[model samples]
Target: MLSDKSRPIIQATLPAVGAHIEEIAKCFYGLLFAAHPELMDGLFNRSHQADATQQQALAGSVAAFATALVNSPDRLPENLLSRIAHKHTSLGIQPEQYQIVHDHLMSAIAEVLGDAVTPDVAAAWDEVYWLMAYTLTHVERGLYGARGVSPQTVWRQWEVEKKIQETDDVVTFVVKRIEDHLVKPSLPGQYISVQVPLPDGTRQSRQYSLSRADQGDSRQFSVKRVHGAAGKPDGEASTLLHTNVSVGDVLTLSVPFGPLVLDDYSGRSMVFISAGIGITPMAGMLSHLATTGSALPIMLLHADHNENAFALRDQIRDDIVALRHASIYVWYEQGADSKLPVQGVFAGKMDLSHVRLPDNAVYHMCGPVPFMHSIRSALIALGIPPRDIQYEMFGPDLWQADYE
Candidate 1:
């Protein structure tokens, strides 16, 4: 129960907080790390901590919820709620984690707002936070229930027994050993966390989607180098992977898990839309779909900066031709002279608005945050059912707004 004086501050600041959630979240993280250095071993990835942009998505999403809660007098946009929940869901965020965040976040907000704060504002925000938390908690519980698993039920590390490059930027790593598991069962679309030592000697983990949809002994994951951020072009983990990490290099591995999967997508026209490195999972899905003989209007919508950066473009084209009901829409951001089945392959940005998103399609999408937001909004406007749509963002799953 918050005091009456704090109510307005909670309300007035939330929208702005939502708008600039990233900044607030940054502050929260700073305080958390500064005050509780011990939490880092289990919580913060040292490599990711160095890359500020890497954690911005997570913080921004948390702040977004804070902003929305202040306006809880009116129901939050269902899309916002769902999108946020999904984002948290992807990172294996738990309900207890929310309470911890709320406590620290409220403290941070009070500190930020200073003398202007009051009891009512705090109470209002508290109620709102708990309410929003309730929404996500229930949904997440249902998701866990459906899976019949507990939080962190699947998280582990592995050693890189062998590695090979599928392309200049994309590499395939074969995990030969992990904690207690020389072999483990992992579903396709699930990913393993590859921990790499950065230049600073600190370590980080990046999730790479498995190239196959099977629970087998020899598990493989394909990772695409992520460039084009404000800081550096090539990310540290990927750069190290391409330039340094080699066979016999052991990397911490997590039990493969992700909301995005090839299952539960049966008998549907699987529309796979990917931009740049986002195509990694799509390649796996396409490859698996081809083998399973259930390719239904599998439109592999791929957009790249230019012809040179089109990862696995030729493979998708070739597979599309071989498999019935499969095709590729190639969009080179710079320009493409090729007379491909380009359903509007211009040398500009690929926005989701131009495409007549097929109806009754089970959508599997991945891209930058802004790109995913654009496509998600377009899909909703086009009357696509939320369940029919699936997406995975680069940084965090803040798809609380994108409810399925």
Candidate 2:
């Protein structure tokens, strides 16, 4: 257990450490990759690794560790551990990588902080680091215990059968088989990683929220093209998945994983808020609700550029039409002809004021950063706990920014 004296030091040091986090992340990745190159073959989705999310997440974890030491000074929460373990489990991060990350992280902090790196500061950080590593180490081991190995164990071949365009930028991928049967039971809201062997031999991988409702059907990923940053194109993998990768192209797919999943609505009510392609996971949830005929009160709130581009609006309404308890609030950013299957309708941004969400509503939301942040801030201000909120990234994990 951490003593009272340790709290103030860690709290004070966190902001200082956070300022140089970018540099620390650069050094940490450099050391990690140089010492353990084989990790890329198994543990990294090349495209997502290139994206800053992974680096930011690692750095944020360190900062959060510092916060946890000062504030909680107790056991790591189950939800936090579950999310961390899921990240590593999906990436196939092994037990050894934790030590490598720690050594390099500590080295980078020392190298950057220079004078401020006192004995107490170093010791405090050490305490935080070990606690985090301890949590991840044990959590990963437990996850690996029951996770029966996936068919496409390596980042090699995942055959893409069809690429259907949902929007100008987003496309749905139909992957026939990874190494075995295509139709296996996947939890609703769970996502799979897609690895594409690029033209230059380096592979790029990305996570796509599975758009399909039925887990019993063939796997399909509805991925949006993120026109890559710093001269990088919309990810080699996502570009391939959208443009060239079609009918009979093999790509690598990791097993489905994510903590943002549906509950045994055998008895509870919930609300889902989505913007644009974020509607996919909610579609899956609604489908399950329809199939199971669950009496849970489902309220869906979606904000899109327009109704025409509203991905699953009508399909969702029709799915559970019998359940009058299910209602949709559609907000079209563009003043388009808003008509049909929508209640509490508006033509501007999501109306946060006077918004009466269902009693005991669990808000599952996803969208661009600004949109989700606005909604989250509003909800929290209105007395929503963080646990009652769930969201998924259309691209890489945004849990880092969420933490920050």
Candidate 3:
């Protein structure tokens, strides 16, 4: 909760701060990176940095946090904090880093706002930063505690056992633990961060959802080769993994950490909506359900460019077949595969009109933000409560308000 004194200050200054938040974010990253170049080695995503998405995400988070604090002083944004904490824990973010970020962020605010940053105003914003920072650290500590590992020890080595080509642009890596310690069980829909050394001798990490259910000491994840379009740089970690990595190669992976786990909905129906590579986590959930012999009705509705672009189609099909009350519906923009053993195959973008949605079914979706927005609007119009729908994004959560 924000102090009464600071709440009014934040309310008055939020508009000005929000207006220049992007510039402040840009300045903060510049200052922080110039002072602590080591953070760029593995902690921060250089690609996101170069593209300015990281700055946008940071700016949006701070503005949103501040706005939420003013609007509802009694309650914090647990969903926002939980999402950030999970991502931080997966990246092995330590508590001390928050202090570093605070210092640079404050300096950025001061530099950007100049004379507008009175001491009282500065102190009020400080409260906001620490409040958000502490809340995140508290949540991250619990995440690390639950995993029984500290930030430094959250990563482990896993050797690639096989690399199966899922599509021309996608490949699935099956890896087994190299150490003697027992592998921690991964819940369905959880993701692990894979850190790889780029050709430049710098390491970068990227999160990939567990594409298969827990297999004792082994795990599976898929990566799509990112071909940069429209002047953007290609994905460094993904490109390296696809081209350089092979069987028997060792990779560093963080323990599974994600807030979008599929809960044990014993008697209820589960609806999975996905497009492109978003199917990875859904595949994990389906695999888990199949392995556990779940009786819950499952409906998988997926969208893709074409049959050739659909990764894990066979695996998803097999998992759906294993479940007693599961069915799949696929939509292809170009054409439909009539021979595919699915409940309904349609041509063009995914339309819920052709399929029957189960009564009181919980919806979980992942895809591009626009696609999710379209699906969500459709679902809401069809009388599904927004509270019952959950979604996951591939990169920085720029569409936080939209999802909420």
Candidate 4:
């Protein structure tokens, strides 16, 4: 909770701070990287940094956290905090790093706002920063403890056992522990960070969702080659994984971490919704449920460019059939499978009205932001509570503030 003295100050200056949060974030990253270039080596995603999505995410989160502190002094934003904590834990973010961020961030705010930043105003925002930082640190500590590993010990080497090309742009890698150690099991919908050493002698890390149920000594994850648009750089880590990595190559991996697990949906109908490469986590969840012999009702609603573009189609279809009460639905925008079994295929964009939604169904979605936003709105119109719908983002979570 914000102190009474700081609350009023934050409430009064929020509009001003929010207006220039982006500038402040840009300045903060500049200062941070200039002083600590080591952070860029493996901790931060160079692609996100170059594209400025990371800056936008930082600006949005700070403004949202400050706004929440003023509006709901008694309650913290669990969704925002949990998402950040999981990502941080996967990247092995330590507690001391928060202070370094605070110093640079405060300096950036001072530099950006100039004379408008009075001492009282600075102190108030400082309080807000620490409140968020400490809370995140506490949550991240719990995550590390629960995983039974500290930040330094979270990474392990795994040898790629198999590489299967799923589509023109997607590839799946199955990896096993090199030292024959017992690996921590990954929950459905969780992701692990893979750190790859590039040819230029620097390492970059990216997170990929586990695409199948955990085998005792191995894990499976799918990566989509990110083809950069005009004037953008292609994904370095993903490109390396696709072109250079082979069946015998070793890669560094983090323990599984993500907040979108299905622990609370035990007795309810589960709806897995995805498009593009977002099907990875949904496939993982389906695999787990099928392996456990779960009898819960399940509905899989997916969208893709065409049948040929749909990754894991055969695997997920088999898993759905393995479950006693489950159904699969697909929407292909480009083409349809004429020879396919006739029940649940549709043409064009996804329309929820075309299918029947089950009672007490919890919706899990992952895809482009626009797609999720459309599906979320449709679900809300159908009387589903916003709380009942969860989404996993592929990159920096820039839309969290909008959802709040």
Per-candidate TM equals 0.75, 0.85, 0.98, 0.97
Best by TM-score: 3
Predicted candidate 1 versus true structure: per-residue lDDT over 1-404, tens digit per residue: 22356556666766655655566566777777776675454345555566665357566555555544444535455555554554444345677877776877678767766664577666776776676678879887775555455567535455676686666678777766556633345554656556566766566667777765442455667778766566645576777787787787776655555667776355767788888878877877776776667657778777777766776666566566667877666667677655555445656777666566666778888878677777777887888877677776555554444522
TM-score: the better of candidates 1 and 4: 4
- Candidate 4 Cα errors over 4 Å, as ranges: 180-182, 338-342, 401-403
Tens digits of lDDT, candidate 4, 148-238: 8899888989999999999999999999988754467999999999998988888898999999998878899999999889967788899
Ranking by TM-score: 3, 4, 2, 1
Worst 10 residues of 2 by lDDT: 148-157
lDDT, ranked from best to worst: 3, 4, 2, 1
Total backbone clashes of candidate 1, pairs 3 or more residues apart or in separate chains: 40
On a 0 to 1 TM-score scale, where does candidate 4 land against the true structure?
A: 0.97
> How far in Å is the alpha carbon of 360 misplaced in model 3?
1.0
Q: What local distance difference test score does each model get? A: 0.65, 0.71, 0.91, 0.90
Lowest-scoring 10 consecutive residues by lDDT in candidate 1?
A: 395-404
- Candidate 1's displacement at residue 155, Å, is 3.4
